[model samples]
Target: MRAKLLIGRHARLPARLLLLAILLGSGPAGASSQPPRRFEDPLCHVVEWRTPPERIVSLSPSLTEILFAIGCDTTQVVGATRFCNFPPEARDVPRVGGIVDPSLEAVLLRKPDLVLVTRGNPLEFIESLVRLGIPVYGVETRGRLARILATIAEVGAVTGRETHARRLIERLQATLQDVRQRTATLAPERRPRVFFGELEGAHWTAGPGSYVHGLIEAAGGENIGSVAPSAWSPLSLETIIERDPEVYWGTFGEEGEAAARERVLSTLRNAAAWSQTSLGRRPRLFLAHADVLQRPGPRVIELLPELARYLHPELWSRDGQ
Candidate 1:
């Protein structure tokens, strides 16, 4: 089955050119013709604020990261999920609960004027917040990289930080373009096949239309898991062996980094076909902080080059350049 390609959160593109088009009201075909003034969320709700929101509750970790990245005052951010522990300062923010199961009581105690959520949050929870007259913005990061940028812009618009958001987007775009230029010329056959295992126990991997898949493509590697039907799916052990990817990359969370790395290495080494492929011989396995791959936020741009270097060391070598 051909995997359906989903738009990535930070896919490589002609940054300057795309930025110019977006700023000039001439973005990619089918995109909005003007810079957003009112925040329109994925749930199709229009959110407008007379003044910048001073008290905010961020239910999504990615949104929390975005709020901090775009210069939202930390003091005004009253509540964030426990997982929103990036920027170090975010750890200081009061935790509401887990991303998918935030506590309404805790969120209410924050007295937030605005709440930021993602599609993963329960619809009923969002509805309850709306029923209470709190302004809720539901951000979705499922398909395209553009949606991720749009989420940034929307948050900036509602929070009155449009300038900061625009600048951040430009910087991110520049970095994305740099990665693209370096890898764009690689021949298809030359690109290594890569498998991104999200979880070792179930053989869980990222497939077509996922942010990880986009990252793999941008880094000049073909994602072997792209045959799956959705953004994330499990691949059978037989399928993985059949693919025999040249490189194996995965994210380790909760489990301490050292243990996670050792566990993943041992699991791969024990596979029946471990002796038949590049991974079996050289074991080109890499483990990264889970959030870097899972969170669709500004830091993703920071990690893109690192992924590129891992996937194509020859291109990144000092002698090669």
Candidate 2:
């Protein structure tokens, strides 16, 4: 089936213009001889299709979402993991498996022309698919919004839909820029200090390089745990008590309010010192979906306003008193 594209004729111009210019001049014969660079994809390890892939399979939810954004067509996607539930239409696709343990047999049976998976996926599964002569494209997002757009462009090139992909990338960039401008008036002091994670185990929170930390900053909040080197890290209860963030955030919706409360209590219980701190006394905790909070995709824009409201309720007010 053909993919549906919302981007119109104008979006197709840039790539066409470049091709015309290349033809008018002369094509570089040396360009084909260059070895594939680390960051450069359509890499030597993977085989690229001359024609668009009619059947596709996605291993990760984020990749699946990107595919749909490019406009998934019928006969295109035969299988996806249980976690790829964005855009709602993805639910209709067959569920092959989940993270860590993917169903290789199910993937093979679907006979997809191309399979998209990210770096975190199991090496063995990817190797097996490669051995079977299936085109497996591996995307490494590195938890940044820019990388997400880049991946979309790459996928578009691979699937012969570069025009649609370029437009989508530009629109996403413009939206992000607009948000930045809207929040430019914010002062450093106005930025609320926020902590996010589970109370159980090591008390994980997003750090400096994490996409969530970037989102927190973009939404006008300061992530209390953004100092760590890793994207997600474990923090001590004493450290949390010392920092004493103004707002608390976590993934607790599926469990409901009672369960959420229990989870928060478990963390507070572990951090007994936090009880003495002001933030602990009457914690301004909020629950959000794990995917929305974690996935670095289009839903980030939707989450921004929700975060802004929590960070600065005064700015986001009702129409009248």
Candidate 3:
């Protein structure tokens, strides 16, 4: 499948405009081979640096996780968004407010040599930072699983840790291939129907072009929300009932496991329509660690096996034992 480019909510430019912008902003790949490095971002914008950045700030939690996974020095990572609390050590990094509404002043105060951003960040904010001579690179990691792995490579290359990045990619690729191989032979009729509840409120779910949909497909389950028009959309309770999903998965970010599970169960139990489905009767509801499942980082790989076990317990023999 072709990779989908995610430009975030703030700068939802048309594809033509986005391509033009990238063409105008960037030079040809491998424009030079000297001490100062130049690399193109997912948007095709060229980012040049005198050397690998020493003080980096990550505006997106996913990017923060990728940086840490690629083995970037923690001390050099001066700032991260408030939600970037993964890998344990990330908590020590200074917070820069929320992902979309990050404090520009706080970012500037860190005096980072490089600032990493993803979709949902305002383009104007990035431009302002550029004006102030701060190098900002946009890392797009949405849609397909391949795109997410590519983002890891991009981050590694930009940080001058290509070796580490390649190793991580290989590991991820191997795991994905193994999962695909194991689940590929299952007949369509055997594959369980799944509903991925992205948010607890209003019945938001993963749809056709979203990464979560990809995850569902990879784990040998059919995503009922794949019928939705957009990547993420709100489904009516009637629609969910009509599909009659066998499994329901939700994620919790800051909430404790017990609290998250209770909240998810409460939300489902209260919905009269949802309570009527097979998922409600047997309650195949499962809770995933929000940071692992929601963030488009290396940890997303961890979700595949968990989902497979949920959808195909007999194949696992003893719940992935």
TM-score of each: 0.83, 0.79, 0.83
Say what the RMSD of model 3 is. 7.2
After superposing candidate 1 on the true structure, give the runs of residues whose Cα lies further than 4 Å from its correct spot. Answer: 1-37, 198-200, 318-321
Better model by lDDT, 2 or 3?
A: 3
Please give the RMSD of candidate 2 to the true structure.
7.8
Candidate 1, lDDT over the whole model: 0.78
Writing each residue's lDDT as its tens digit, candidate 2 over 221-278 gives 8888876668888977567767777778888556776798777866664677666665
Report the lDDT tens digits of candidate 1 across residue range 283-320.
77767888876788887767788889887787778556
Q: What's the lDDT for residue 164 in model 2?
A: 82
Select the stronger candidate by TM-score from 1 and 2.
Answer: 1
